[model samples]
Target chain A: MTAVLRRPTAAAPRARGRRRMLPFSPRHIALIPIAFVFAVPLLQMFLAALSPSAELIQYPPPFIPSHLTLSGFQRLFAQSDILRWLGNTVIVSVVAIVSNLVLCSLAGYGFARLRFHGKNFGFFGILATIMIPTQVLMIPTFVMFASVGLTDTLGAAIVPWLASSFGVFLMRQFFLSLPAELEEAGLIDGCNRLQVFWRIVLPLAKPALATLAIFTLLGAWNDLVWPIIAINNPGAFTLQLGMANFQGVRRTDWALLMAGNVVATLPLVLFFVAAQKQFVATMTFSGLKG
Target chain B: MVTHTAVLRGSPSRARARRLGSAKRTVEGWGFVAPATILILGLSIFPAAWAFLLSLEKWNGFSTPTFLGGGNYAEIVGDQQFWDAFGHTALYVVLFVPASVLAGLVLALLLNGRIRFVGVYRTAIFVPFVVSPATTGILTNYLFDQQFGIVNHVLGVVGLPQQGWLTDRHQAMLVIAIMSLWGSAAFTTVIYLAALQDIPAELLEAAAIDGANRWQAFWKVVWPELAAVTVFVTIWQTVQATQLFDLVYTTTRGGPLNATETIVYYLWDTAFHQFQFGYGSAVAYVLFGGTLIVTLIFVLVSRRRSSEVI
Candidate 1:
């Protein structure tokens, strides 16, 4: 059933959408309160993190402290291996980022461009794994890694993440949107398939690659459960595990715990802010397609 | 779509080139995808089969397995704590999903119209989504602490009644729900915000010219356009809520009286805490089955609805 009714003519690039002549409208007045609801938790966390211990226990804690101090951060660095955990976090994040970029783009390119037997079923098999609950995989996967003696190492924490279902899906979607003619031209010019992909295709995939990198960075940095399941050694703790352990030992010490949370969370906050458009585009792409 | 185009172009070429060219293309294609297949399939599918096999046996983390057939599944069907966790999760999902969806959509609508500082507002909202769930758990635990927590402090200042948060069973659920909302809204809001932006302006203008006011125009014009997205958000949130482990694990650990224990958390507790690998695998399969059923319903319903509209 060959059905090609209409080639999708490129619509005008969706830029410069409906903008009112003046920025200030009755809408902005309405928006402030709603946005405030979303902003309050992060703000309160920051304020609490900044408050001195005396100020924190003073009956009713003030949102704006009379004076702010870095005693908590100082004590955090002085007492614990917070710096080591942050390093481990960076390693996992960077490895996961690079691996997802290369592996997912390669697989996504195969799904999008190449012709092979079992291609449809193979791709669908990958997609189906997205619906399989992560908990089901937990026991077997942990055992699988432990069998290979990689359980408490960084390898255990990052192996499953080297390629993600969502990363592959996103890359494939981006690749599909690209015109096949670009790759065909490379093939006609006596280039092999891999060369065509590396030279002619990958340069144009900067946006998709950026999206994959940001997604992996966020996922790897913020990951908690897998590290908990896989790595138990105190020295091997990822950032989240380190922060969790810090909270446990310093139970009532809200100042230090909140400070730890802020320290751990700040990089991701900075990352998202730097790549806001890419983040939003990824969100949009996933939602709209689903 | 790309695959369809490939098939269309591939057919005529196959007539002249026959199997050898196709065979060579297949090998090249496999070469590209094999690395991912080896990794993903090894990590995903192989484990799933292993899990299913483990579910049918009775084994702890150690010792040789004793085959128990359907005994674990039978036990799960009659388990009280399992059902208790199930009820707790249902309640959590009930409170969390609709509220986040509605809150996300409303904020998206408010922020939709050409506005200033949208990026600033978005960063403020989306910041929560990027923070580690465990970090969020720590932050919220402090915020909702009954006696010295700032949430209680603010409530007292506002002359509102101070109830025990993170203390009472029902109140603990509310606290977790609030925390879930704080973490979840950013992603949902971004989705809704983008969908709102994509709604063509001409459709809204057409409704206005037909004498529809803003609210009526939104209902008649914009609402239908967003139905698919709303469904997507709903299902995404549902699956995410069902896998709600890290937040509860960090905050309460199934808490004061098992009031907040969810399917995933309980699965973790059973598998890891009790070292009952077989039993844990059974519970995992149950969760997987339930998720698959729910997701299938959503997909089928949405598919039929879209096809009818076309």
Candidate 2:
């Protein structure tokens, strides 16, 4: 991950481009206002989540509160299933991250390295699934899960996410980038394909695997629609869906809802901060490929 | 939760197993792919076919589906709300797609070269992308709330009137567009940055040495390479924007005279809200067709462009 943050050796080329750069250059003194404009909404969200509920709703709208309090957090804890939702989210994310790392890496290794029959055809078939929107499948999936008696279960919530084609593709691409010599050496040393994958390729592919795991965790943590549709029981509700229940038709508790939002979003922000370097490079790469 | 089977080539425990290697390989392939294939088919493909069939029926979910033979499709064609939803989706694409792509392109260009803290900026911008649209939907509701929203507060500070961003029908879609913009622009920027890196520096330098300006070189050389990325983003944005329901459901529920009501939201309201499953199926198919057409156009254009480059 730190490798992504280190400046490239091609500084001379960048300097040449910089010499003729337009107003959009990174060094442009003019971009400050635009950057500030983009930053305000996020700043406001953070501030509003911290502000006292009454001050937030005041007519003049206190920009900066005199007394900052955790009353909203208290209200959220008292009113909603914040903890249970968090637990559910954690369970879902962990399962998804673990399964994606193991299964996707195995599958990706097979696709990238194996000489199995119908490999190309099978891979393309998987890619075709990307075109199908989830909405078109929602009702049928619900019916199928209900028939299997898996409805409202965490199994149902976590399974579809584990079959992430994007993860498979990312891992496969990384595996392709890896040298074949290590795996070949392992194979010659009487290790089987699965063993070679587990022992050799998997260790070498740590950066890519970590990237996939983080992405899966983030996705599962933030997902709302699938859980909402699959689970009718409140016990199974993930944080996002549970937080959405804040908008009860009769009354609006702005402070508590914002606080819940903060709680739900804060961990991800922390995670991003911790993994910022890897996250950016991986994001940059994933965008290009998919 | 299927366990990994003992390998025919490797497992000593299964050494005496009589299963033919060919048969075993075939079975293993299917087994490995089974969970994904079944889930996708059951949840996605089968439901899509069922939705198509249901579109011909006239049934609320409570009653048995009656074969009305295109009645639902006919009704959808004439329904003003269906068209309104289509119009709103189109309007959303018209406003959002370009803004997001341009924002993405500019940001990518800005962050393309070496900078000391480019990673921090990238992560900060991309943070919103990881946020569930549901959260964005809810957060934006508070942010754009006319009476107490931070948006209105900022506008008031600038001496502008506080607008009812989510309530006013005319303004509701714009709010949705802005939220969509915020979430999607990061992704586009990420994609564009990748594409920019893939461009050969020698070609760029050659153009620069030939006295062509940076803008000209970008237009002539960079945009062509970025074409594939652009097409990918547009098609994705179209599919997502067309099927947008989460944000709409959370923000406005298609209220304020059904102004912000998109096709999927309308379908949800009709199916789950009104229990008109047949009508909902019809609307779903219509959105599907819309997506298919848009996707086809993108594919055709990209194919042509790639061929031209070849």
In the range B22-46, model 2's lDDT, one tens digit per residue, is 4666565554444554544444556
* TM-score leader: 1
- Choose the strongest candidate by DockQ: 1
Local accuracy by lDDT, each model: 0.81, 0.74
lDDT of 1 by residue, B47-132 (tens): 99899999999988679999999999999999999999999998898989899999888777755543467666667777787878
Clashing pairs in 2: none
Estimate candidate 2's RMSD in Å.
4.8
Alpha-carbon interface RMSD for all candidates, in angstroms: 6.9, 3.8
- State the displacement of the C-alpha of residue B247, model 1, in Å, after optimal TM-score superposition: 0.3
